[model samples]
Target: MKRLSDHTDVQLTELFTLGDIDAFEEIYNRYWLKLYSAAYKRIKERATAQEIVQDFFTSFWINREQVKIQTSLQGYLFTSIKYLVLNYKRAQAVRNSYAEILLMVNNSFDNSTEENYNYKELLERVETEVNQLPPKCRNVFELSRKQYKTNKEIAQLMGISEKTVENHLTKALRYLRVNLNSLLLLTFLFLRR
Candidate 1:
């Protein structure tokens, strides 16, 4: 009696379709290495290539009855691996994009919420000076600097002349600049110790 290994590819296919385990085993033995090699050449990852080949065989066996071999089983399997590699790459690209976006969002959030302690203290000092301004001057400063409103927009909202808006902004900026310069000098002296 001839061994299943000696059978032709056509004979193995027929036997395998009829649920012959020995014929299936022979086909697996013949093609497993070739299939794994094809997968690895494309994916370049050992474990993932192994899994693709293993899954191909598992599906081929499970769907034997429904499988139509229009061409050789070898061709079918290599084609399957090509599609699997393409799909894996596509999935990885999508995941990488989402990871990048998430990283950008996290970095922006950190920059806003985790500012340097000394910088936060400097901002607090500026806020104290801003509160000491006359009410109209404080409102103008908050609108122009904090809310990012233009001089013309502040004049329109506050029912003041544009010149008055400009004067208030100039006064507020000059006061803050002088105070900030002195604070910076003090900070420099303290750090030198």
Candidate 2:
């Protein structure tokens, strides 16, 4: 009865790479719970933590044949867990977007002064950023924002291909990201203020 914990990480990886299923099982058994605990500590949600750890193992198993262990197994395992935790955090970002979009959607009729102010602030910041775009990007962003034009519609209006219009919009967004941080902070402060 060999103890999985007693085996060197290199030996475990080598054994796994040699198509030994039991050796791979041993590797998984040794690390899965430990990895799960690491994830759980960050997220405090069992389902998300479970999903993260599960994805980590899935990636490792899927690439087991070609998997090269350049670092120690502990390093590789922890690195995978870190990526999974980051992904889990990112997916939850939609919660903020959805809440803002919902406020924008609902404020149309209720006409609360606060909500209306927030909507106007969001629009003003967006407009300011859009105005600062280069000519081509400004034109494309305007068609899409003011006219509610689809990418195809905007492309046709500009006599450019849809791909070109998409590229312009992409660049426009990149520019806004670079330029709009202060405006975004002001807008957020106004909404919360």
Candidate 3:
């Protein structure tokens, strides 16, 4: 009797596709550690790497029927993990950038009394400017910036298309940029000090 381990990956994959759970188990056992190590090397976070590898396996099983492997299974898994790591890194970068923007906005004024007063005045001006926007544009900008809704979600909520929501946001931003140029310049200079 040939042990499951004696079979090649292609053989095991065929068996797995045929609903042989034992063959799947053997493949999992053979590749799990290697996959984990590959993920760890790229991500450099133990927990995140573990989660990525585990998620890949879960997705692999769930999407097994739809998955068509042209290369070896090992190559396919490695490529999948590589793309996963890249996506994770890209998302992390976006979050980091958002955090930095929030920090800059929040910390624009220091504890100085004059600066604090200026901050209040600036905020009021910004609020007034936002309120002066066209109703749809203001609503879309508020939902996107304050409520943090995606364009698609804003479109659904407003009964408009995503393109319309995008246009509204663009219009609001352009208006604010033109109207509040000096305020933005002051804020930038203040932050630079």
Candidate 4:
């Protein structure tokens, strides 16, 4: 009898779908390293890449019976990793944004006296800068931040392409970051005197 590891991918996939633990193990052994390497290359973090690969295998086994691989198992696995990487990056972007805002707030508090740390005035300054953005860019930025709409939703509401919406957002953020940093620096200098 051939070893489970010696079985062709088609045979292994068939056995896996039928809840054969050995077949599943064989598949894992065959693909885990390749999948990890691919993920690591894209994610550039060892721990995250390992976790992504582990999650893929865990889900594969859990949903074994329902998995419908129309193409080769290898193709399906690679496609799954691609989407997993995309999701990880999207989630990371959101986390990074929150972290940046938190750091900015913390630093501002550290550098200013109670009298100088006026949150309402800071918010008003931000609103003033946001209002100075070009008309369409300001609308896009407001829809995204104030209304909490997604890029896709903003694009639909404004009748613009998603890429255009993204560009407007990027431009707005760059402008705000530059302007706000300058304002903060000036405030710090004034407070020191």
lDDT of each: 0.75, 0.72, 0.79, 0.82
lDDT of 1 by residue, 76-175 (tens): 7788878867765654453355346335333433243334455567568878988988999999988876787756578889999655876787677667
Tens-digit lDDT track for model 3 on 20-122? Answer: 7788788889999998899899879999889888878877887788878899988988999898787667545544554564476677767989788777887
Q: Pick the candidate with the highest TM-score.
A: 3
Models 1 onward score TM values of 0.55, 0.54, 0.63, 0.60
* lDDT over C-alpha atoms for residue 61 of model 2: 79
Residue 54 local lDDT, model 3: 88
Please identify which of the two predictions, 1 or 4, would achieve the higher lDDT against the true structure. Answer: 4
Q: Tell me how far the alpha carbon of residue 176 in candidate 3 is from the true structure, in angstroms, after superposition.
A: 12
Best-to-worst lDDT order: 4, 3, 1, 2
Model 3 TM-score relative to the real fold: 0.63
What does candidate 2's lDDT look like per residue over 133-191, in tens digits?
A: 88888998677656767664676688996558767766766676667656666655665
Ordered from best to worst TM-score, the candidate numbers read 3, 4, 1, 2
Task: Please count the clashing residue pairs in each candidate, in the order shown.
Answer: 0, 0, 0, 0
**Candidate 4 per-residue C-alpha lDDT over 1-193 given as tens digits, one digit per residue, 9 for 90 to 100:** 3379769999999999999999899999999999999999999999989988997899899999899999999999999998878866764564366358647755655544563556557778989999999999999988877887766578789999656877787788778888888777776576566
